[model samples]
Target chain A: MDYGDSPEEGAFRDRLRRWLTEDRSWSSASSTDDEYWTRQASWHTALFEAGFFALAWPKKWGGQELHHTFEVIVDEELARAGAPPKPSLGYLIQGISRFGSEELCDRFIPGLISGRDRWRQGFSEPDAGSDLASLQTTAVLDGDEYVIEGHKIWTSYSDVAEWCLLLARTDPDVPKHRGLSVFAIPMNQSGIEQRPLRMINGVSNEFGQVTFDGARVTAENLIGEPGQGWALAMTIVAFERQPAELGYVARYAKTVSELEGDVRSDPDSTRREIAEHIAWAHVQSEMLRLHVCRRLSERLDDPDGGVHGSIDKLLMTWTEQSVGQAARHAAGSATSQAGGDSRLGTYLYSRSQSVMGGTSQIQKNIIATRVLGLPSN
Target chain B: MDTRLSSEQQALVDVARRLTERLGPDGVVSLDDDDRVARLDQATTEAGWRRLRDDDGDGRPLASGVEAGIVASALGQALGDTALFGPLLAADLLRRVGIDAPGAFTVALVPELSSLAVADAGRLPAAVAVDALGATSALALLPDDGGFALAAVPIAGTERSFDLTRWVSSIPAGTELEEIAGSRTLTGDDILEVEAFALSLASADLVGIMRGALELTVDYAKSRQQFETPIGAFQAVQHLLAEAKTLLEGSISVSQHASWAVDALDAGEAREAAAVAKAYCARAAIEVCEVAVQVHGGYGNTWECMAHVYLRRALLSVSLFGDDGVQLAFLAARRMGV
Candidate 1:
């Protein structure tokens, strides 16, 4: 089995690297939370314009229709260049393109792809975090619109997004999973109220809590059939678990390199324990990177989404947490000093890695029941 | 890049698996079956598995590191008590020095068994011969100018080992060594490549050990009843097995890359990859084996259950080159200059 890039992939990677090296307009650092997000948006637009975003999407939807490895290359190059992460909208794009109607895709995908319109996913509530299927959100059909009323906690990007893809119960009599439906509701409506939540990293704009009093969406905004939201949500999460698509491996690599550099620049002062931690972190990063590559290669043959995503999610969590801990230890006193380095924020944010996408326990449960064919109570 | 095995590699794996399953020991008791052990050894020798790294007349091996790793993994899964890795490693060392291996031989490591042994003043120092079953001699490195000269030291005696499937021997202190004629001096890069090969094989063996242990435990979980139902129905047991499976998959990914890198990448790069794989697989195998034992409950601790055998084999592989801590320290020194 070959691990090096194919000829076409090598050429594409070289071209992308050259372009990234030549472009320095989007490299400015931001000071405020608002400025950070604004810069992220501009970076996203620049990537899309340069054809480095959504490399796996269809050409008809403003993508190059290249292999997913191209996407991985883009992530690796961007991280190597110390650029802001590529926009994390691949899952949303997957959900809409696969489950949304033709008119819905035509109406929303181009805008989302081009970064002209931003979106947030409203999947979890205070009571329905891990048990998402048990959500009590309701969406009722009334003439040409569906009135949605739900409380969504951890609604990321809600302040900047113009639309929110929501999951609400459409038929209550059936099982929880079967009764759900997805909707593309406009976030600018008067019935929706968004309150930004301060994250552990002290960033408020990254996450919000939204209460939909009586949000209205046209019936055409329904993603799929009334009972298809569960499948669509699963598909979206499976895509989200892919570390390659999410650029997690690249980010971890960057962290690992920086840690190594820190230890190297002051070897006489650095402790062996910290050096070992950095080495351990490097090992985790390499494992995750190689694991993601193999998974991406497997997807080339079997594109069907399956329980394998749970495995990827677990590995990603482990790598992120390890790298965060290594960075914290490497930073030593600097982590807690005034005007704290970013390592403290990173270490704190890593605490949510196992909690945000799916808890480690939940991922294990999925692997136990679905992948291992273990019986459940 | 493709990570899946090619058709030829898959075929090699199938053949190795079939041979081991047919002749290799089935349990702890079978390990003492001299007739079966001899038959297995004869079969592997006839199959030319040990000759995978033998020179192909171009100073390169007849097969790549992936091919050798596939066989190593198969042998590990079946607990095949054969002289494959030792002889193969000896051949690899000889090939690096542009000489054909004379016969069945293994590599001599320092007393701690952490690295290759270096001969001093035309005599072999006290060293260990790992995987030395049925081998006449072990190869050592003799310091020659800035490079190392290849030497063969006679194995003095076999010693009892924690791992029952393989044998270890000792080289007497100040044992006279003979340098092979017509051999070229090997560079530092050549030694690193050999270490990479050794580490990759060890990682592959750990992967196989984990696979075997998990499969055995999974089968037991499916059949062993508790609380009027199979214990596999319980979330605790299922999670243990699931986590073990995840670790096993991670080990496979890293090991695959390491084995491929041995022949496909530069010597330094390949060594780094192998070090990463070895570190991950060494730690993962212990945990996976422990879970296997835990899932088996009381029977797991017994000698007859076969779970302990996998653990024993994994322990040996973990110490073969260097455990996780050793690898991490080496990596830290290399990457961070610590």
Candidate 2:
């Protein structure tokens, strides 16, 4: 029942704080979005060299083979330091380490761990968003290669990623679930084109409407069996939806304190309104954080207790959206005013929290059917 | 950082759950019956459940806050016909305030439960609305000898309360009041300790009530059918129940932590943790009960369905110490250092 960090964890956290304080590059890492990947890559490399990256992975794969607590500690420290998130790093490293072939692992794992390369998740499409198995992307078998042709919407950081973990249908005649295959496609190939979609926040999140027309992936790039793409995608997305996605609740705590400060600093007229908003944000954030921490603790105890991920997804969306709304409420009329701050834009961006990583409605359905064991209609 | 309950704690919870099952609705004919309430209370006291906070022969607390919390949460989950809270809380408060009492009774004068207005000070007693049921007396603060003193005053009359399971007692004027041993001027830390226990136990109760209501609704949804399919087959019904389940689960997580904080954290931290738990659980419990009724459709609204019972208890608990608004304001004010 003790929730405080262990003595070891406290020491690791202090060390991390000292390291971040000494590293001058981290101060500008988040502000330099123009070179997001380059800045984030170097930061990730620094974290790796300092033995903080891939904490849960085996030591042979450039990881420290530490417990999940180290990962949780790192997540909290990164949020506290305000470092830019290496969004796809977890998916890329865990995906390859777990399911990729030996040669595939030797080729891509080191590069990813060292932060020399980045990967983009290419699972969602315009027609097949939540029903991801119905993705129309095709990767037909060619001579020693799979020629890929498809359009991927909302592929985050696609323009910056050197590689893409793309899910494409190889045998359309078969059932949608069994006909799919995943490929590690080189994003720099001749037929790959990425058009950045400016987010509602007026920031290029590096999200792109990527078109892969006859983009060829070598035979060695295939991950797992051809029919196993659906399962593989599920695995990767599960990691994306876990409490790891909440960044160990530290990020939300930071947002809440910032909002609380805003509420207190405001004048009397707006104080009550903003106070209520902050209260809701603060309580809901704590609720979600506690729930996620318990879930992670459970997972640490029992890895097969994996089906409750939809709960985390739902809570994450609710908390993020609540925090965004509270931030906007704190600003009041200034939210609509030009040249104030990006809080309003961030609120707009929060709308995607429910949309991406599966919609809120979809998460509800999963909870109802899979977790609750309710009859599915 | 371990969140799992220890084996002893697990055993305590199991025993508590067994007690609830034996005395809950399935075991008792009517929880509102005074005879039933008294009988349940006696049985629990005989089982040594009433003196959990009392000192053992070695002068150590018989049970820790964490252990008390487990038992309280289990009793809360069952929310049976027993009058456990009053005696348990009274015992805990007596230990903190350094008082010794013989029987099962509740307390007043806490910010969440009741407050006192000092009038002419003497041995004379005054009437106050104390939120407790099935207790011999209530410990309230009275203006005595130019300062506040804790007294165990006899209950003159019992009145109906919003929480059907518990009764609000009316203290008559000029009743005999026995002051507790070592009772004197209260300190700020004393109030905070009482609040920490009250709020944590109440939050745990709300979590249990929510879980109980949600489980009942899910069972009903599975068996009840419309249009040649179980109502649970429909996404509309399923989503409602799913949301209720999520709320229950989340409340449990927070409430458990709050309970732990009460046992282990310092007074200031424990107070804040209790407030957070109470605020969230109060809102969540009310929501879970309301949605559980909605999922049940018509039958849920009937008195026989047991949904209203949950709603009644949840509503009563939510407002007892201060509802979500009171707690949030307290929390926000603390955060602002106001």
Go through the candidates in order and give each one's C-alpha lDDT: 0.86, 0.73
Chain B TM-score in each of the candidates: 0.98, 0.88
lDDT of 2 at A233: 86
Off by over 4 Å in 1: A28-36, A335-339
- Count the clashes in each prediction: 0, 0
lDDT (tens digit, per residue) of candidate 1 on A1-377: 88888999899889888888898876533221444565777888888998888888777778888877677777677767766667788888988889988888988898888899889999999999999999998999999999988899988875888989999999999999999999988888899999999887787778899999888999888998888999999889888887766777767887788788888898989999999988988998899889877888887778764568888888888899998899788767885577577776778778888998788888888888888877775
The TM-score measured for candidate 1 stands at 0.97
Model 2 steric clash pairs:
none
Share of native interface contacts present in candidate 1 = 0.72
lDDT of 1: 0.86
Looking at model 1 chain B, report the run of 10 residues with the lowest lDDT sum. B155-164
TM-score of each: 0.97, 0.92
**Pairs in steric clash, model 1:** none
